[model samples]
Target: ISPQTCTEGFAYDRRARQCIDVDECRTLPDACRGDMRCVNQNGGYLPEIPADPEPPSYPRVRTTAQCILGYTPAEDGTCNDIDECETNSHHCNPTQVCINTAGGYTCSCTEGYWLIGGQCQDIDECRYGYCQQLCANVPGSYSCSCNPGFILNTDSRTCQDVDECADEPCTHACFNTYGSFMCNCDEGFELAADGTSCIDLDECSFSEFLCQHRCVNTPGSFSCVCPLGYYVFEDGRSCEDINECDTGNNTCTTAQVCFNFQGGHTCLDPLQCHSPYIEVSDNQCMCSAENPACRDKPFTILYRHMDLSSGRSVPADIFQMQATTRYPGAFYIFQIKSGNEGREFYMRQTSNVSATLVLSRPIKGPREVVLDLEMVTVNNVINFRGSSIIRLTIFVSEHPF
Candidate 1:
């Protein structure tokens, strides 16, 4: 049998993994498994192993920020764009425009509101500003306030005419326009209610009851009146009365007493007695049979005197008017008081020289003493002759008050 040596000196290719034998005589070979050969490859030392080995790592893809170099994430994890306009914290004069980007801000000129020192500010519209009617400022925009009679409806952004008449722009009425209003009064007469509407005046009619007589109508106004029995007084419209009595208004009856005065006449009492005799009561009286005494001889005379206050007593002298010789029975004298309360009054007395007074039962009301003389004998009427001194005594009950 022949013995072969595994360790030998040679060069080998991986793709063409074939081993090219080394010249053993020129190269020095050390112990490689007891006399092995030594070989070299493109990558360096060669060792005998398997083909198509596993690699150490995989390929990686690059991101945008990462691809563009020098870019870094902020603390918020966002990338920022640098602003050149505000780079050094500087604004480019008053005329330059400023703009802001992702991470920075800028400033520029716009309309209305302005920018100062790179900061935005407001503009005063009330100054000689650009609002046609009125002005209002908001941030970077402007609004309008309509002139007096003209108004702007903010919701519609349109101009509405203000009614000057409605607003009473002038004293009474208003006429409104897009930007203003006017006032006026109409026709022959002035305004009726508002300063705008027209009204008429009646100058041809008697306006005031100017006719002093009956307000007669001629033109605008009028007059005075003179009544039948009156003449024009001091005042233009007043009249003075002319008395009808002076105008002969007296139409009196033949028996009527016509007493005439300044304005009229009156019929008075005739003062002539139509009925005769003396009064015995309120509406009655008696007529005497004879007026003259025939002759004065031994004839009897009886006169009774009565006291009005006391209903029970008579004057002492009248108690003995005549004797009981001819006229007998009794005569009753009644004293008259004022009321009809308790008793009827009468008195019985004898016509003797020593006559006694007798009072009757009491009575009331305006009383009268009845001089009742009667004949006890043959019914012969005693003749009362003439006047005599009759002493009358009055008796009265003391009032209880």
Candidate 2:
């Protein structure tokens, strides 16, 4: 027998088990399916992934260190971080600061801060930069704070400024002394209005009665305010009335009707009395006529809804309702102001009604909001001598309600 084969191929021996090489390709021609192309290796097989597949997965496939995450041969193939900024997976948090170190990356807060941006970050313990007192570890960096009433020294990370004013242990202006200090209020100085510092004293009285005009006082100071019309003069003690007429701004309505009095200007009303000829008295032009009474044909105003056209519901500030005839009677303007509490006249429509007037009882006291719209008719022009014509005295008064 030969060492290669005993029989035609490898015949089954009774003592030694022997078999021939079977051709799997000739037996199972359709072994691999789809677009996969399989190839046999030493004790395993491999397949080419399909080009049409969106993503491919193979647990049996072998991979190298270069393609794996955090894989580095220099670090004994240990997992290490990739420089996300330089490499691929780099996603910093919003407003967070990202920094990559050897085999890893670190995150820290920006200047003037100690809180994280609320995202992923690695802590750097070896750094000298940290918050002042009590640095607490947060998501990214650390937070700094001072003790109770003590503020951060700012210059040094170890020292703190205790607000002696706030700390009840202090006595008076909290003067910071070395590691600690005490509160203090200076001499001749009471607690400040804000209770923070010492203040001085005012020698004036607090009853607001120092001068004839007015008196004003402040912390360690006092002043006097003169009356509205009076002004502080050269003496600084006595007050004087401000000559409004001297400034050409006197409150006189008519320039010819004003009379400068002792201390103020007087306002005169143009008056009209029932008379054939006018007579000037006090500011009124009184009449002294023989037959000036309207006992025969009187004057009046006519009032009626004539136009029949209603307008918008607005307050009637002023109206001109034409009477039936402009002669004979004249109405006495009695209550010409806001009446019925808040009730105002609304001229939605108007009228042309005739009305004749007669002498009625005179109204005594006036009321609120008296307007100055007055009118009176001239019945007949009579001249006592070569003077002016006769004029009727018309008086208006509001209701007292």
Candidate 3:
């Protein structure tokens, strides 16, 4: 090798006897072009290329300096803010807001929202007690609501109670309270299970003693009823026997007497003498001594009248007959002598001097019955037998009670 020729980026070292590489980046300040870095290789120096190989072109105009982004140069040689909001040139999303600063503008989330992880998120206004009853959150906004029985007020944040009674929800009456309502029924009526309807109150079924005789249930009240010879008292709960004789409500003729009892009335003939009998007193008749028919007839006949209810139960003691005068060593026997064709009545001898008239069978009627009850007295010491007859007329009512 005559002179040891080296490459352009290499230098020859005499002592070492070899070409050496040079660090061009450290030795030459302008080793590479603008915006490019320099590197030394084993045989040559290499210039590092940039990502953008070409530089930006600018206008051929004379100016002191260029303004930064989001600003512009003013006529007075000062930087001015580029109002991105007014010019609609901001980088903020459509739902965000843009605010201007000294030399630039900033992007921020709108009202009722906050920036979270570079995205606009709705703020939970309800957590701050923004509404009195209810709240709902939407994108960048919020709303207030009310419960079922309340209404939103004009303030939009407060709640007011709704008057449900204004719609007439109750059948009878309605009462309004805070956030609720109630229903009430009228007199003689009751509230149903549904709480908004009314039903008739069964006053008669509630108490059997509401009426003395019978209870009649009406729409909303009860009435007392009495049988045919009685009337309801002024108190509307008791019954009083009607005196048909005094009230002239009986069907007695001119020759009959009207007799009143507890539930009915009867007509009876005045004391009169039959063919072989003579009237001795107002209620008694005796046999004539000269008449042969009187020999077989009873020694004395007494007239009586009574009233009873229809469908009278059997074995019911209706009347009692006791001998007024007592004779020593004398005993009496009782029998239903006549007018008992159906055998509805019988005589029960309780003692030697007394007898009871019992209903042996049930009798139903708006009718009348005549019974001839006889009592015979036997005196063995006097060796005499005498008999008395009671002509009793019974009037049965049409009702059982």
Please tell me which model should have the higher TM-score, number 1 or number 3.
Answer: 3
Please write out the lDDT profile of model 1 over residues 314-379, one tens digit for every residue: 332324343434334333232222222333323344433224434445423233334433222222
Give Cα-based local distance difference scores for all models.
0.41, 0.41, 0.80
Better-scoring candidate (TM-score), 1 or 2: 1
TM-score of each: 0.25, 0.22, 0.70
Of candidates 2 and 1, the better by lDDT: 2
Candidate 1: which stretches are off by over 4 Å?
1-53, 56-105, 108-112, 117-119, 125-128, 137-141, 153-160, 163-188, 192-194, 197-401
Weakest 10 consecutive residues of candidate 1 by summed lDDT: 61-70
Q: Select the stronger candidate by TM-score from 2 and 3.
A: 3
For residue 308, what is the lDDT in candidate 2?
10
Candidate 2 Cα misplacement greater than 4 A, ranges: 1-200, 203-208, 218-220, 235-237, 251-256, 259-266, 269-277, 281-401
Q: How close is candidate 2 to the true structure, as a TM-score?
A: 0.22
RMSD of each: 30.6, 29.3, 14.2
**TM-score, candidate number 1:** 0.25
Which wins on lDDT, candidate 2 or candidate 3?
Answer: 3
lDDT tens digits by residue: candidate 2, 132-183:
5555555445556666555666553454666564465533557666456545
